[model samples]
Structure formats: C-alpha cells, structure tokens
Target: MNSIGLLIEFNDGRVKEANFGMATAARGENRNLVALVADGPAEDAQAVLEAYGVARIVNIRSGNRSWDPARQAAAVAAAMQKLEIDSLIGLTSPSGRELLPRIAARLGAPLIMDCIDIDLEAHRVRTSQYSGKTIATIALTGSHFIYGMRANVVPALKEPAEAEIIDFSFDGYQDTGYEVIETRTDGSGAHYLAEADIIISGGRGLKRAENFKLLFDCARHMNASVGASRVAVDNGWVPYAMQVGQTGVKVNPKVYMAVGISGSVQHFAGMKTARMIIAINTDENAAIMANCDYFAVGDLFEILPELEKALAAAKRSKEVA
Candidate 1:
C-alpha cells in the first residue's frame, strides 16, 4: 500500500469543497490517505476530511500566521518524510498552483500540475498540452511525486473513515526570508472561477465594461463566479484574472453559462469538463449553440434582465417556502 498524502486547503476556517474531490481521487481500498494542513484549523479540517476517506490529519503549526511559502514547503516536506508519504496530491487552484511546486522543489520530487487524471500505482498522469490541443500522458520517475488535480473533475465521493489530528512542526524548517505584508483582491473571496461550482462567462456580447453589472446582478442571485473570454479581456472589458480559455485558466465547474460567446476551441477546452453548459447567443449559427446542453437564441440585453428577475423571484419563493 502506498502512503498517500492530501494537502487540505481551507478558506475562512472552512474546508474548501474542492479538497473533497482531491481526497476522493487519492483514496482507494489499498491506499493509506492522510490530510496535511498547514497553519489552518486542524479540528475543522479533520471534521470534513474524515467524512471523505481520510485516515488522519496533520496540522503544521508554524506558530507564525504569515504566508511563508518556503516555511510551509519545509513543514509539508517534514511531514511527508516523517509519515513516509511517497505521493502528495492537491488541487490546481490558486494556492496549489503556488505551493505544490515549492514543496516539490524542496523535496526533490517530480511535480505535475493541472493534471486531468492520475494513476497512483503507475505514477502516470494525463494532462492537457499544446494549449489544450493534445492530452499528454506523463510517466514520472522520482523518489516522490506531487500532483495538482484540476477542481470538479474528480467526484467528491464519501467513504467514512477515522480522522485524528497530529500536531507537527518540522524538525528544521527555516523562513523563506519573505512575508506577505498585504494582499488585495477584486473583493471576491472563495468564489474563484476555477473553483466555483457555477460560472457565468461573458464575451464580446457584453458590449461595454459597465455591462458586466448585468452578469454580476445575475451572479448575485446564483452565487456564481464571473469569467471572460480572451476577446473580452483584450478589449479591457474584464481583467485577465477572469479569463477562461486554454491560454488562460482551465475550469471544471458543475454548470457553465456562456453569454455572447461563440465557443472558441480554446475556451471550450478550458471548460469542456463542465457537467452542464448553457449558452445564450443571438446568432443561430454560433458554435456555442451546437455544443451547449441548452441554447437560448435571443438578445442578451432583453433575456438577462428577465432571467435575473426570475431567478431573484425563485430564490425569494424558495426562502419563503
């Protein structure tokens, strides 16, 4: 049996739902699964990790509550060595994108990021390559391997298991000589596009930057993240961080809504894994119309307002009921 470790990501003291998917992918009948949390609430993490097949949770208490990449990497490496973990898996989300490589470098392990599929025994991975034009199968050969799986593709199936927290401070972990003084975002927290359950993306159809308010208004009712196509970002309609395509960020949300998008190959490659896709476009011949699960042909300006109001009414009615 392989000693497998899962990096637990938390937001606001709550376990991110995406971590469950990672756990599910790492667990099997012959695997030993453990959760490694760094500077987060171990008790809260254990509660969720335990429900999803984790055998134990290790809390890396660095005592300093600052964002230290090097120190965090050392702590995780220490745990990996002490626990005899041959492989570690995490999400391809923001933190995973940043932390996994650091840990891999520290541990001298081969790192694979944004992998679509994994086979632990063979140490093989299937990941997108050539800007989503090809799916490459990689065979890793090293003392250890770290994989970052894209969110949502792996189902978060629960198989109840025992969870116990172990407090671990690395034997010899030093600071990375840097600290985060301040962090600023676009005010959307825990609603990242790549990690969102539902994403509403706008394209050239938005017409103006201010028109995003319509999408935002709808998103407020649905609690969804906003995404944009390359054209929208090129036109300065939205920031690059919100771009969703092969050249941008890959997503695997449960439901993806494409508004005013023509469904370019790059854009489709990014969200093709989405379970459900809804498209709203005026052009009947738009590629999105054919590829989407549901298509609505109409003027977005007219359809969006009615959709938003109807959603609001539905939410209110549900709450009242």
Candidate 2:
C-alpha cells in the first residue's frame, strides 16, 4: 500500500506534524504516515494525532517569529522526502492553499485541491472535486500524488496507535522576502458551525438582531450552531460570520433548520448538502418549503419559542433519566 501523509493545523497557526490517522481509521488499514506539526509544541499536538491512528510523527520548527508559508512548505517538502511519502494530504485552509502548491512544485507531483472524497483502489487513487458538484476520478500517472482535503467533509476517526515523535530542523530556504507586521485573529466563534452536526439558520423574516436570540436559544437547546442568511447579514441583523450564502460560509451539517428564510439560490448554495432540511415560515408558498424535508406554515415568532421550550424540556427529561 502507498504511504499517506496528513498535514494538520495546530491551534497556533502552524501545521501539526503527524500521520493521517483518520484515513487509517476509515480504511481500517495502516500505512507509513507522517505528520508535520508547525509552529506549536509537538507533544500537545501529538495527543490529537495519536487518537487518529498515526503511526509516526515528525515535528518541524521553522524558528521564525511569524508563519511563513514558503518556509513551512520547504519544511514539509524536506519531511516528505525524508519519509519517502507516496502521497501527501493537507487541509484546504488558507495556509494549505499556499503550501500545497509549493510542496507539489518542489516535489514535481500532481496536486489536487478541495477534494471532498477519496478512494484507494488497487494501485490507484480517486477523488472528487468542485464542491462535489463534479467528480473527477484520477489515476496517478506518477509515483506520488498530493491531495488537499476539504475541511469538515471527511469524518475524523479515533483509534489507538503508538506514535513515535521525531524532531526536525530546517535551514537554507529562499526567503519569500515578505514580513507579517501585524496579525489579528477573528474572535468570532462561527468556525464551529462548519463542523457542526446540526445548524439552525434565520432569514429576513427574523425581523431584528434581538429576534436572532431565539435562533441562538433554540440552537443551544439542540446543541447546534446558529447561522443566518445573507439578507440578514446585509440588513445588519446578524454578523457576517453567521451568514450562510454564496458570499458567506458553506456548511454541510447532518440537519439544517431554516427559520423564516425565503430560500434564495445563493443561500441554498451554502447549505444544500445538509442531509435533512426543515423550514418554518408563515407563507405556505415560501420557496424554502419546496426544498425542505419538513415544513411548518406559521409565524416564526410564535413557533420558535414553543420549539425552544419543547427541546429544553426534552433535554431536562433525558438528564433526569
């Protein structure tokens, strides 16, 4: 079997150096895998990697004050060469966008980005593209192929595995000649929405920012995340982070609850992958009803609070059980 290396994202904005444990778990097989932990301490990151079934880990320290994509890429390429990796897998985050291309260029390998799924067959690998709207089954013409996995698409798995941590240091790389003078991280907690199992979203009929609290309360009761339509964001009723549309964040949760949303095409683009969609609106002819797995025709203000109370009572009953 070919070796697969997974590049992980550390909380410190560096790549976590470790093997692809989730892939191993999903496949029920083990391969030569190496993880690269960038920027953060390897020991802390190793715990998460170990849970995923990584066999070995390679920790790389760039010794730079800020995250330099080029430098990180150089480190990853060096590790890949040392490990003799047959394929490389990375998260399709902002850093991956910059690093994967550089690593592919340095290694002279085919790069596939934003892969939603992958299949390993006899002597070949396959993957999907274009937000899963299109499928491109690829046959690796070369010995090595690099893939960037879309975040939240692949289910992360945990399996106990012995992980050996190795430290590596790098030097003598071309400086991209760029400096990050100031860095400020967005404190919005909306990132959880991307990985959420369930999402509850609101639209223009939500009326005002204060009304959004109902959505949030319902979401909390269900242990779900809150989202909003682009119209709500544009109207200043919600933050841009909560917006779900073509211009906003894309989500593929197991269940989606859309409240008072008219279901514009742009809004549907962001959440159409939801396994089940439930829509609530006063107008029975609202566009959302047509696409919903379930629909309720009524005033949102009346329905939302009742739903919240019902869910809350259910939670309390479960706890008492």
Candidate 3:
C-alpha cells in the first residue's frame, strides 16, 4: 500500500487553512495519509489533521533552530524516505514553493507545482495553463511524486481518522548558514491576497490614497482581502505589495471584486482564474465589464460606503442572532 505525505504549513503557530485542502487531495482508497510539520510543533494540529483523513503526523526537528531552506528540505526528504511515503503533497505557498523543489531535487522525485487537482490512484494531476485559459492533465510515471497544490482550489472535506503523532529527528544537514535579518509584512490587516477566499481590489478610479480606506473598511466587514491595480500602486495610492497584476501578485480567490478598475490585460492576467469576478466601474465600456461575471456602472465612492455599512450590519445581526 502507498502512503501520501502532506507538507503542513503554519502561520502564527497554527495550521494554515490550505493544508486541509491538500489533505483532501491526498485522500484515496488503499492509501495511508500522513502529515508532516517541519517548522513548528505538531501536537496541537493532530486533531484537525485527523478530521482531514490524516492518520499519522510527523514532526520533523532538525535540532538547530534556524531558517534554512536547504536543511529543512533535506529533513523532509529524509522523513519521507523513513516512512516510505510514495507521494508528497503541499500548497503552492511561498515556503512550499521553495521547499518542495529542493526536496524533489534531493530525493530525485518527479515534481509538479500549482496543481489544481490530484488523482492519487491514477497518478495524474490537473493544472491551469496560459493564465487559466486552458486546463491540462499530466500523468506522472515515477514511483515517487512531489505535488504543490494551489491554495483553496480543492475544497476541504471532512474524513475522520484516528491520528497518531510521531517525533522525527533528522541530523542530515545542520548548517545554519542563513540568518534572518528582518521580516516585512504587507500590513493589510486581512488575509494574504493569494490565500484569501474573497478579494476586493481598487484601481486608478479610486482617485487618491486616502480613498483606499473605503476598500479596507469594506474588506474588514466581509472578512476578505484587499488588493490594488497597478495604476493604483503606481500612483502612490497603495503599496506595491497590494498590487494584483502580471508583474505583481497572482491570486486565485473564490470571488474577486474589482472596483473602479478598467481591467487591463496585465491586471486581468493575475486574477482571471478567480472563480467569480464582479466589477464596479463608471464606464459601461470598461474592459473589465466584458471579462467579469457581473458589473454595475456607478460611482464607487457612493457605492462603497453603503456596501460597507450593509455588510457591517449583516455581520452584527449574525453575531446577535
């Protein structure tokens, strides 16, 4: 029987929501499920991993507490080898993107990244190509495979399992060559744009920097992430980190709300894969109108405040109920 290993990621000492989706992709008949935690403790995550069909959790400790991608990848590869895991699955996150490839190179395994779906039984995976213009199914012929799943593409399904936690110490490579100088955050106060389920982005039509507060206020009430068009960033209305475009961050949110955006090709390339798109622009002939699922021609300044109030009221009502 083959075992599937899930590379669990953590943010602020808790499991990221996308790991559950990766666990869902790892599920199959006649296959054992294992979760691997490299950067943090695994005991607190055992219960949640169990709910996602993970029967065993491996906590990898390198003994040297340092941020070294090379060492961490070697440790993960070693753990997989010890457990005889035939497949390793992880999210296409910043850490996973850097870590998975190194592990693949170390283990000499066939690697696939940004996969939207995985068929464990058939050793096949589905990916979006040409900026989601087409879907491609690729077959893996190797006995061992490393796959990076796109965040939130696979909905997490609850499959209860009795899980056991194991501690694994790997002294394979212990060179703390890299030291962290500083960490920078986007400071959006919401979820990361790439990982958010819903996103609301502003563009040049927002006029000035202060107007971005409307976007932030509405985002807070919706529990969604905020993004900005390249024009908005270039005009100094928002930071470059908030930019969503071909040259900026690519997002795959469930719903992408474009406010006062003209939807240039570069901007569309980043968010075209969103499941649903809603556009609000003053021009009916705006390029975003044709590409979006829904659109409303209006002044965002007037519309946004009302939208924020309505969302806040609904949230308070839900909490009261």
Worst 10 residues of 2 by lDDT: 13-22
In the range 204-272, model 2's lDDT, one tens digit per residue, is 889999999999888887889999998899999988878876777777788999998999878887788
lDDT of 1 by residue, 1-321 (tens): 777999889887899989898888898768989899988889877767889989888888755677776678778888898888989998888889878998899889998998989999999999888777789999999999999998877888998999877889865865557777777766756378898998999999999899988999999998899999999999998889889998788888889999999999989988887899999999989988998899999999999999899989999999999
Instruction: Judge candidate 1 at residue 231 and give its lDDT.
Output: 95
Q: Quick one: ranking by lDDT, best first?
A: 3, 1, 2
Residue-level lDDT of model 3, residues 1-321, one tens digit each, is 678999998887789998988888788888789999896769989888889999999999966576667788989999999989879998888888789999998888888888888888777899877755678999988768999988988888999998988899998775647656556765745467888899999998999999999999999898899999999999999888889978887898999999999999889878988999999999999999999899999999999999999999999999999
Task: Please give the CA lDDT of all the candidate structures.
Answer: 0.88, 0.74, 0.88
**Span of 10 residues, lowest total lDDT, candidate 1:** 182-191
Candidate number with the higher TM-score (2 or 3):
3
**TM values, all candidates:** 0.94, 0.82, 0.93
User: So what's the TM-score on candidate 3?
Assistant: 0.93
